[model samples]
Target: MPHFTTTDGTELYYTDQGEGQPVLLSHGWPLSSDAWQVEVKLLADNGYRAIAHDRRGHGRSAKTYTGNDMDTYAKDLAELVKHLDLTNLVVIGHSTGGGEVVRYAAQHGVGRVAKVITVGAVPPQMVKTDSNPDGLPIEVFDGIRAGVLKDASQFYRDLTEAFFGANRDGSNVSQGAKDDFWRQGMLVNLAAAYDCIKAFSETDFTEDLKSLDVPIFLAHGDDDQIVPIGAAAIRSAELVKDGTLKVYPGAPHGIHGDYQSELGKDILAFISK
Candidate 1:
């Protein structure tokens, strides 16, 4: 198992494959790098070196009760990028991973990064504070914490429906896709999953969003039930220095899987330009 030791000495697992411009992917909450398998293959096929990692406490990485917050998550990624010595990289993050990339780019600067994409990402903050009065309420996250504590397996199962827009009438539901999501969610440490609920929900990314100096692509689904398009993705594109927004009609939060082919084409086109 290929791995890198974080600054705190935690062994983190990652997969590096193909060859060309480095494209690093970050997975969503309670999920692993397995979530990016389809996109990885597509990127590699399109002539880009694709890399993805399981966040500490998720997938094959060590499960720790502490250091499960966003800062540590960003730092762990920073170390991985440095270890690989990757340059002119394009970082794509989905859901919680989107928040991670924003913070990482801000903290580390664009010395190595060429572009960034946040798909159905939680950024510019998720939880409502005095400044972010329009953000999601704490009760929404509290419910998630409760679900993880009481019954994570079933909670994850329910998440797939909510995440993929399966709850919507006339929506196409794929059992295999739901199963894949459950499998990835189960691979993560329950404690880490629980802690990340707060990490992703509360962390403020205002400073991070304001610091970007490279092109940022904010792609999101208009019908995302998990993270509203207006509050997150739409608002995020507006904050970045040079950001572009692309919203898919009738697509769900997992746009990477729902519209993999089209999304890959768009990404390849962006990277080529």
Candidate 2:
């Protein structure tokens, strides 16, 4: 239940456990530190300091109506890293959290970081534009905003299928995990959740990814319905200077969730190198 106050006066909750080089995790949209439960334990057990935090207006963090954009989200992460005075860090992000890591690295210069891993992340871009011809349409995100506003619970419930690859084929996921994902979405602040749909979808991380000098491991699900590999990890890996993309066949956007053991091992190996 450890909490820190951000510069914006928002109280952010985080969990820090074990000892060694730090391994920090940033969760996906409408989720919190709780989403990193599996990775946190795995990292800690592998002799690393595992830390995860609840983004503002999500989980136990303050439910503010403002600062739900990518810039603010990245700044919040910077604050947490500075507050903890952590170093030799290995940062990981999933889905929208991946964009957070990219932005954080771009702004912070990778001074304290060793390497990074992004699982089913959003980077380079998600929403389509003249530059990103392969991206999804803005109307897609608009629909998400509208859907969440209309019936948040149902939206989350329906999103679970795509998020976990259940809609495509037989999903390698448990019903409990799907329910947990739904509950986390419902716990998010309604206004923050709505605005975040715009943040993660529209924010351009092309420059940020290009600026990253540290090794970035892009772990994604090939069968991902939420953030397709072609538009996301595939292009994202091309941006970073020292990037490697690994796709899990028949996996979903929450690839790390279903492949926790393999993901953990791969991350540890990359960081160790």
Candidate 3:
């Protein structure tokens, strides 16, 4: 397991494979770099270096109690890019990781980044407010926190259905997908996972999205149950300075798993363009 110690002394595990223009993968909440397994292989086979890291408190990374917010998450990503000394990098994030990618380039600048892609990403903002009335209500996130506190294991197990839209009518999401989601989520530190709920749900990325000048590819499932497409990908595409939006009709939040073929093709095409 390749790992790097962040400035704050947290050991983050990561996977680096193949060779070419680097593609750094930042995964969604509660899960880890393993979430990008399909994309990593696809990129590597297509002659691109695919790198995915387990966020500070998920997967094989050290389970830390502090620094689970977006700012810290972005800083940790900056440290990873610095540690690898990568340039012309293409960063792709999913769900919570999408917020990290947006904040990373917004705060650290796009000196090393060449392109950005987000799948079923949470951004622009997820929580409802005066300025953002389309966003989800705070009560929704509070329910998540309650679920995490009451029974994390059961919470993860239950979340798997919606995460992949397994609960949907005529859905084809595999049993393996739900199982993998639950397994990876269960590996997360309770404290870090709990804190991350707020980071992904409440952190505003409107300014960050407005600041980006690099080419961005926003992909979201129109049927995404976890992070609704209207508030996330659609709105994010509107906010970014240079962005291309791809809406996967009837696709769920776990697009990487269920729609990897089409998603990979789009990513490769975007990188080539």
Best by TM-score: 3
Per-residue lDDT tens digits for candidate 2, residues 100-174, read 988987887378877888988989889999999999998999899999999999999999888877776555688
Model 1 residue 22 lDDT score: 98
Show where candidate 1 strays beyond 4 Å: 256-258
TM-score for each of the candidates: 0.97, 0.97, 0.98
Candidate 1: minimum summed lDDT over ten consecutive residues — where?
Answer: 254-263
Show where candidate 3 strays beyond 4 Å: 256-258
Clashes of each: 0, 0, 0
lDDT of 1 by residue, 171-250 (tens): 77688889988998988898899999999999989889988999999988888899888779878887889998999888
Candidate 1 residue 61 C-alpha distance from true site, Å: 0.9
Q: Write the per-residue lDDT of candidate 3 for residues 1-273, one digit (tens) a residue.
A: 799999889999999999999999999989999888888998999999999999988999999999999999999999999999999989999999999999998888478888889889899999999998999999999999999999999998899888878888987877887888889999999999999999999999999999998999999988899999999999998898899999988888886444778888999999999
Instruction: Give the Cα error of residue 140 in candidate 3, in Å.
Output: 0.6
Ranking under lDDT, best-scoring first? 3, 1, 2
Top candidate (lDDT) = 3
Candidate 2 Cα misplacement greater than 4 A, ranges: 256-258
Each model's C-alpha lDDT?
A: 0.89, 0.88, 0.91
Q: After superposition, how far is residue 144 of candidate 3 from its true place, in Å?
A: 0.5
